[model samples]
Target: MKKFLAAAVFSCFSLSLFANSFSEEMLNIYAKLSVRFVLMSTLKDELSESVNICIGSKAEDERAATTLIDLMHEHYPAGIGEYKIYVIKSDYSNINFCKEASLFFVLSIEDIDLPKVITFAQENKILTMSYDQVLVEDGIDISLFIGREIRPYISLANIFAKDIYLDNVLLRVSKIYKKQEE
Candidate 1:
């Protein structure tokens, strides 16, 4: 009861932030859904006792990253499930700061800096989620496919490369992302 109420309130607050733009609205929706999908991962048990989520960004996206962390703290005061949530703000240059993270939510970053982050995440077996769906094709573990009904967009090859596994239920409903061959 209380849980449902809290989620409803949070959803309203989240959606309100990007109500002016359809694409921004989809991003907000995807951000919220990302939280739920974390629990559905088969590797959830391997996460730290206090799950560390790194909001990876460049200098330009610092404000957006901070806003996201603040919102997360406000809405998830009790953390999610039995795992305590710890949001860390990280810059692209200092990707090492996120080595302890279980999940890395990459904000809009330069193309050159992206591969470094992706490599780090893959090597650490940390789940990589992106704010932009286009990044999914670039080796991000997850994003949302904004269509008539939004759905999760996942890169199976990338996740597999990272030795990360999601539950079948999530995979069933997601749109598998395939990298384009040159």
Candidate 2:
């Protein structure tokens, strides 16, 4: 009985550690994606001097949003004076507010009308990014996928539709998908 109880406790502890590690890995990926998006956007459009990132998510994903926000601020401090981060709640009215943002990060789709949001983003020429691979298939511009390692999955149709251009280096590394033929 004592051995069984000890093993159960150890199993729970191991699971907890694995979850934390995975969360940290995700956070790192998000931060890297944010920086790459900002840099690439700046390079694509010389006229744009600053990058504005809107982090959109449902209420339940507030912790994830906060983690990304903190990581971004740490990497690109306010002293840099070239980028801004905004937290946007899942609200229809907030759509207008996020239109001005250069890039939109969809942290969570639950409780949010993703299709509606994507439509608004497309109409406004905002680059949509997410960690969800399914969103990429559903027309989101950029998605991070982790298989053997973290990799970026991009939709060429969505990218061109938004008039967003990525450099050849990024294009080479990313797995690009196109719309299906009729």
Candidate 3:
């Protein structure tokens, strides 16, 4: 709990401001990072068909959720041309939400049951990610702000991809999780 608060405090600068206005600059960063991961982690030599990816409602009306959907949906083909990506909106619950996501984003701790979220993600072979303070404390993958930009990082130490492989192009985007003492 303490760790999460510290992380949230450090990252609050990027998230605390909510103008209800979407920033293209922010979206661009997300798009690039996501493209890097998708391309790198893809398990194929040739491009696969459309895959169903899920994003959670991290905010009321899910502003961040929509932003992610737009990023994945818009960038995949434009950036990789041969492959297609699909973003599924999560219902934010154990049963439906967890089931819907192949890649799940943690929006906020307040909106989730951490243990359940983690368990469901692992059991379902879903990749869990978050920008939430608490989930990060619990060692979930997260995207964080450095200066004005936030980037994706992960806790895949316990999570592994099988026949699926992550390529250098995507791994370049993932900064391995290293605990920083506050």
Candidate 4:
């Protein structure tokens, strides 16, 4: 019984460490993406006073949104009036707001109509990002993942399809994906 108890405690400690590492990675990704948006906007001559980020998530995923918001605030303190993060329910009515956003991070596409969201983003020049590779494959602009290392998978097709212009420096660092020639 003592041995079992000790093993359980060790397992819990290991799990917590893994969770902390994941959280830290997520925070770093968000910070990098925020900076990328600012730089992209500047390159496009659309530099604004504040970068608007619209987070789309279902009601059940509110906790994830809250965590991301907290990280964003921590990384970008109030004194820096450079970015604003807004959490919005994934709904048709909020499409306009999403279109106006500088960047849209979809927390979960399960409850949302992803094609519609993508179409709106493409039409409005809003960059879309997700942690899901499936979404990236479906033409989302960027996907943040950790496979031995943290990196971004960028879709060149999606980027060029949009009206916005991304700097070549950003392009060179990312893993660019282009559609196969049929």
lDDT for predicted candidate 2 compared with the true structure: 0.67
Per-residue alpha-carbon lDDT of model 3 for 1-182, expressed as tens digits?
66555545554435434434334455555555554454455333443564445665544637666766776666665535565666666655634644644456664445346677767766766556664434655755545443333455655553463224565554575555655663
Pairwise lDDT winner, candidates 2 and 3 = 2
- The 10 consecutive residues of candidate 4 with the worst lDDT sum are 13-22
Give the poorly placed runs of model 4, Cα more than 4 Å off: 1-24, 41-44, 79-93, 180-182
Global lDDT of each candidate: 0.74, 0.67, 0.54, 0.62
Q: Candidate 1 residues 33-143, lDDT tens each?
A: 656666677568777667778887767667667667766766577888887888888888888988888889986678998899889997888888887789988778898
Clashes of each: 0, 0, 2, 0
TM-score of each: 0.81, 0.76, 0.64, 0.73
On a 0 to 1 TM-score scale, where does candidate 1 land against the true structure? 0.81
Q: Over all chains combined, what TM-score does candidate 3 have?
A: 0.64
Off by over 4 Å in 1: 1-24, 180-182
Give the number of the best model, judged by TM-score. Answer: 1
List the lowest-lDDT window of 10 residues for candidate 2.
13-22
Our tally of clashes for model 4 stands at 0
| Model 2 bad stretches (over 4 Å) | 1-22, 42-47, 78-93, 179-182
- Candidate 3 lDDT at 24 equals 46
TM-score of 2: 0.76
Q: How do all the candidates rank in terms of TM-score, highest first?
A: 1, 2, 4, 3
Which residue runs of candidate 3 sit more than 4 Å off their true CA positions? 1-24, 42-48, 58-61, 77-79, 94-101, 145-151, 161-165, 168-174, 179-182
